[model samples]
Target: MFNGSPFPVDAFPQIIRNAIYEVEQHTQAPQALIAASALGVISLACQNRIDVCRLNNLRGPVSLFLLTLAESGERKSTVDKLLMEPLYQLEENLFEKYTHDLTVWRNDEAIFNIEKKSLMSKLKSEIRRNKDHLATNEKLKVLLASHPKSPVRFKQIFNDATPAAIKDYLCGYWRSVGIMSDEAGTIFNGYTLNELPFINKMWDGAMFPVERKSEPEKLIRDARMTLSLMVQPNIFKGYIKRKGDMAKGIGFFARCLICQPGSTQGNRQITSPVVSTEYLPIFHQRLMKIVNESIARNNENDRLCLRFTVEAEKRWIAFSNNVEYEMGILGRLSNFKDYASKMAENMARIAALLHHFNGDEGDISLLTVEAAVEISTWYVGEYVRLFSKPQEFTLAISEADELYWWINNYCIRLKASWITKNTVLQYGPNKFRNRSKANEVLNTLYSQNRILTEKKGKTVFIAIAGSIF
Candidate 1:
């Protein structure tokens, strides 16, 4: 039923991994099941022997018990009209209204500081408006900036001020803080994983929906697995070889010229051949698990998971086809299938290695060259724009010419520096050899009338020719 094609069978791994992560993410955080269970807790608390007074934190259960008691006719039906229905509506309205108020508070803080000119004034205003609740200015800033549903930043400012004041300042902030703190106290909680930048990125990207219909646990779990796979240690060897040398034994360093019969080292005809050596049985298993779980977990947004699973399957099929075409193991279908599967086992390791190590070149030499060219082009264009005007020649010609002269002088040095500059290197582009080469090329081009020229009031002009005619 998807895109007029039957669902792919190979997507099982991704589905299973996705599902496992989803469940795992859910388990890492606390869940709220207020309706049935909370009411049960309240009913138990009603007994004098149950120490109901001591269960003051049992508001959730008590609320549910009241609803149940009303339904049983011990309380008037008007109570539902007055409280239960309104409470449900109020809960629904809270997320949007609270978030809007927080946003307003965040924006107003800057104006408040600008107008009031004192931290004390801002703090007093907040406390006066919100029932004498006390919070640091920074804490308020962070709270207002974050989503209303998000846990308060109690940990960050806990030591900056007294805990007693913070508890007093925010009206409903305490409830959320308490919930988040309770969840953090548990052994398997968000504290460990949420500290990571990647986790926060994924949470912001996947969560914060107007209505979070998709399960939060699934989001966390899948995001973690994806991130983990991305950051996992890579231990694989790969080589880039010419296409014609495809038949040769991999990892054997015989020249492409020997294999291709007409390729050379300098002017060599080349095609990229990727090879790798790493074992990833666990990764594949996890991937399959995710795919399977996605199919089974039919949430409203399950289509996204299904689509990704399908794409993975299609990629595998394409991979299989490439293997069959390369192996020259012609004829029987079974033989082709077996050969393709074996090739895929090898390819997966290479793919995993390349995923991690592909950008280790820092900035590719060619990319650096392109960037240098772009910078030079921008500078030269600005120079021409500045000098090409006749009325704007109030400054001395030599002073105006100095900018162009400096570019010519430094061109070689700039080119040399551009190529060799790297993260580990403390030196700037002016110190690199590749920048020197680029500068040399620029100078040579300038000398040959390849750079610098203009048009002047229906006349042709050139720098090397020194003519405007």
Candidate 2:
């Protein structure tokens, strides 16, 4: 239903473009290409080492939630695996190191526990014998405080995990991670997962509290997660229909960057493997470097913050004002005001991600901000086309056309200049689901001047606007 092209793939950086081209060569879906590239960038951003974007006291994170609508066999999972291969490798390396460290920590912990228990026994005996016990008790307390805790495994990617499990992982390991799933139905259909609030809070970098009755302590952690979900259009629509307005009413869908790209199913030709010829090695190297730097910086609890240059600030402000103006106008984007309102923040986030991806450590440049704005505009268009009831609009038009055809063919064949509502409803091309819907269609036709309505003896009749008997 969208009138324009897909995301501006050319506007991305050279590395991103090369990755997209490589994926597209394998899969003919351009939407899959863009989604895969964006997923890669967001997965890198999940490191949480990069500084936030600050402008006049407003700050935003580089994390994003992207959803792509495609049918099965669109190669969505293939593209996801291709881009996330490096992260999987990184996880494997970290797991090996974690296993080694865990073994050493367990040995040290056993020694510490035995020593603490011996000291506690001595302290209790001294207390019973009326001897000095303060020193021994103090020593036991110090040992307990200094005991080595268990090593937490380093993990950055997840698929098909429940909300509680994800929370536990984020609270124990890195506070940032990415959820990449080709079939998002598992997530959407999970009845036990309280995902709406969990996802919303994570997107805003808010604290999530996990309480357990078995343990006396509670954990409150700030978690950041990036989501890349690729689902078939039919499945997505089914979710929407079942959930009704819940997703939009709660602003879940509004926060997402959604795209439903035109399919190239039958047109895809068998092509040779382009992965070897592409710059994937270089791309993987850059991603690994970024992840390593992020891990190093985060280990030291150092955050790298960036602000816009003066020119970039001015451009950002102008873009914000323009979007605000457009949203205030009636019918401009009334159906999508929620999504439109967040466009500015989303644009800033994109700019920050682009700035980091370009390996720029300085202030964000005006060119970068401009490019972000351009891409954000495209995202807004995609949001409207995908979620603004364009299909319903098309259905209405089709029903109107069917009614018009019926009037011309049936009514004119009978040599009747007018048709009663009852007759039309009985013989109409089944364009309506019920009597009320039929009435609505007839009223719409009357309002459009396609037909004239008359009331005679409590019966309403419709006639072609310019027809002659």
Q: How many residue pairs of model 1 clash at the backbone?
A: 42
lDDT for each residue of candidate 2 in 1-469, tens digit (9 for 90 to 100): 4364667777767776677776676666665345544554554554386646666766556778888887787777777777777878888898999999999999999999899889988988999999989899889889989989888788777777777778777767577788777777776666412468778777777777776678555454555678778878887888888774777877777778888877777888876544444566666777778888777665565556678999998998898877775553222354578887778877888888777776776899998898888788887877866664433587777788788778878776998888877887687767553677887676556545688665557676778889742
Q: Itemize residue pairs with steric clashes in candidate 2.
A: 51-304
Output the number of the TM-score-best candidate: 2
Where in model 1 is the C-alpha error above 4 Å?
1-89, 117-469
Span of ten consecutive residues with least summed lDDT in model 1: 228-237
**lDDT per prediction?**
0.26, 0.73
Error of 2 at 1 (Å): 7.5
Specify the poorest-scoring 10-residue window by lDDT in model 2: 326-335
* TM-score, model 2 to reference: 0.76
